[model samples]
Target: MTGEAEQQLRAYVEYFRDLGVREFYRRGEPVFAVETVAPAVAVASALFAAPEPVAERPIVARKPDFLEPPIANPVSFDQLAPLPKSRVPASEKAAALLAVQQEIGDCTRCPLAYAGRRKIVFGDGNPNARLMFVGEGPGADEDTQGLPFVGKAGQLLNNMIAAMGLKREEVYIANIVKCRPPNNRVPEPAEAGVCTQFLLQQMDIVQPEVVVALGATAALYLLGVKRSLSSLRGHWHTCRGAKLAVTYHPAFLLRDPRQKGEAWKDLQMVMAEMGLKAPAKG
Candidate 1:
């Protein structure tokens, strides 16, 4: 190996050794791809997303209590009416949504804009969708692509949408913060504060029948109250004239696969409110 490559390999070995990993798994000359990689899979958006726990701060994924029954309120979507003053024309939704994007042009509204973010992940999917999914913020992939939920977490969301018998293009998706927080950490209150109005405006345009808050950040911000994911979950809440439901973030599900069943249950509540049934098995 070259001197630089050798040095990097030694540093990697030392770092793992610090983690108490004693043995090396090398059996032969390792193949390293020196070529540039253009990742397309939604899950591959995590450029800085750590696969292993850090020595100082380790993450502990959990298995939720699946036995907890999902809240099943058979609410109808058509019955939902936008608050009187918030009157928005459904026919002009696409134009209105685009107008909001133009208003957010090259946003530097918060420190998040200056924090190494390449692009603003405004929102994606249908502008007139009956269902909208709001996540915490962008990831490495999202920052690179300038779209929400374009990484691995996004792929899981695509499956979730399919399970609801809906196409990816039929639903709107967005985040609590338009920019990716450093290291994918939860967005600060200040960031969410300045950016939330944009989301609210988008909701007004879309007029979705259901809104799914993915994880704590989305749920807390949407509900305007602090509560545990467990407490916020398994029930219907109202936000911006739509029935809101809370669920685990897909990135959290990637880390803790066991909780997917629970997230699905949260989604089912959304589906039920929309009078949706899952697609056929075959």
Candidate 2:
């Protein structure tokens, strides 16, 4: 077979593996039983089949691979790296962020403006924060409060912060898109693109020593590439001059409490780099 045909066959084999055709063996099945095997048409269909739809998200070209494993510790902050030793002067950060917000005044830059958004959530927390958290977008509660991560998920985030030996106010927070997508859907790429400069500006102002992207959307936009959370998580990347870390959004943890441990593991890496220890249980 030509190289192209071999590549095609390899892709088919991988798809079948995803569909649990692992053993390809049964007590009565023939070792070379072409008749018993899934037909070529079936394999082709599997190759073209659409991925499962996520609620509240539109069908884009291909489903966003929110679950990717791109690299294996490409550049682990394996040990504490010098942090917060240099950053935007604390006195100047608040005014810088405020300037970005003023520029975003009553934004009609996208359809979200007419989507019944309550207030534009610029960001919240200490302007001079050494650490910052970025998430997908404002949800219902954040929409109402004009703040990021203020709902039940925010509560969980609060716990995560306390566990990190810090409070919510001690760290800066923002989102990929400032306005809430209707019904809490992921921000479409176009919408996020329009708002990218605002977010980038926010990061520049705070100039955080370290940043944690709170979900796949935040990770995708910050890194300026289509990457799976798996690829970005537990690793560090440089973003607008700050050490970037990726972790699960607190909302995800609320949905799958079991993954909280995994999320903590991701944060502990940040803790180590920042020279933090979990508060002693009182």
Instruction: Write down the lDDT that model 1 would get.
Output: 0.75
Model 2 TM-score relative to the real fold: 0.69
Shift of residue 162 alpha carbon in model 2, Å = 0.5
The numbered model that scores best in TM-score is 1
What is the TM-score of candidate 1? 0.70
After best superposition, candidate 2 residue 111: deviation in angstroms?
0.7
lDDT of 1 by residue, 204-279 (tens): 7887888998998888777776678999899998888888999999999999999989988898888888999999
Q: List TM-scores for all candidates, in order.
A: 0.70, 0.69
Please state the error at residue 231 of candidate 2 in Å.
2.3
At residue 101, candidate 1 shows an lDDT of: 92
The Cα error of candidate 1 at residue 13, in Å, is 35
Clashing pairs in 2: none
Candidate 1 residues lying further than 4 Å off, grouped into runs, are: 1-86
